[model samples]
Target: MPLLFLLRLQHIPLPVRVALSEEVRLVSVLVATGLIEADFAPVRPTGPDAASRIATVKRITEEGLAEIAKMSDAPKFAKTSMRFARGLRLM
Candidate 1:
């Protein structure tokens, strides 16, 4: 399966983030329902190996959140990206 980059963008700890990403499709779904072992497959190398990956995702998310906060009253640039994605359906 493809790695879901978006799935890792939460403000929690590394292990917990990886634990969530391994199975859930979106963070909202994870938050609304809560994490269960059955909800996510067990992450391998459970000790410290997955830490950096999770940390990087967390840092990126924090940066994104900072940027979004600065634009709280503006339309997000993401709307153009979404529009382009929809346009792709016609090509």
Candidate 2:
């Protein structure tokens, strides 16, 4: 769902969307590893309010990171993945 939304965001090209998706997945992993809290709530963009929409996602992501940082266990989260060949093809 989030990936689809990322794909549709106008200012963000396909590569950027892919990067953001990977970041989100890493965020999810951190949450799963007890390193942060995940925002399970969905973000629905109504119109052309790009700034607000981007801010919404960024805020939630930052907050989740903060929550994880406060945890004593602070597990090492995995990094985001990339498909270099696929990205090259897209380019």
Candidate 3:
């Protein structure tokens, strides 16, 4: 699954986060399922007055990490990453 692959790239870019842009549909699914928690900040992408807001991922829930750990294609260390991921902050 995308989420599992996403987690695998945590250290790839030298920091956190797998992707800079995420589809709204996928984000909704992840949020609704309690896979991750995020905070939305209003952004005026089109104009200064635009009320549009963008959300950034804060962290992945323990349950979410467990879900990743169960993935078949996940890294071999995925199962043992729960503790390390618990306090991790996703940007």
TM-score of each: 0.21, 0.27, 0.49
Instruction: TM-score winner between 1 and 3, please give it.
Output: 3
lDDT of 1 by residue, 1-91 (tens): 2113333333344444443344344433333333222123334566653422221122334444544455553456578778888888653
Against the reference, the lDDT scores of all candidates come to 0.39, 0.38, 0.56
What is candidate 1's CA lDDT for residue 76?
65
The 10-residue segment with the lowest total lDDT in model 3: 11-20
Arrange candidates by lDDT, highest first: which order?
Answer: 3, 1, 2
Candidate 1: stretches off by over 4 Å: 1-16, 21-56, 61-63, 74-91
Prediction 2 global C-alpha lDDT: 0.38
* Candidate 2 regions with alpha-carbon error over 4 angstroms: 1-19, 43-91
Per-residue CA lDDT of model 3 for 32-64, tens digit only, reads 888776565555567554445555566677877
Instruction: For each of the candidates, give the backbone clash count.
Output: 0, 2, 0
Question: Distance (Å) between predicted and true CA of 68, model 1?
Answer: 1.8
Give the number of the best model, judged by lDDT: 3
Off by over 4 Å in 3: 1-9, 12-24, 47-52, 72-91
Q: How close is candidate 2 to the true structure, as a TM-score?
A: 0.27
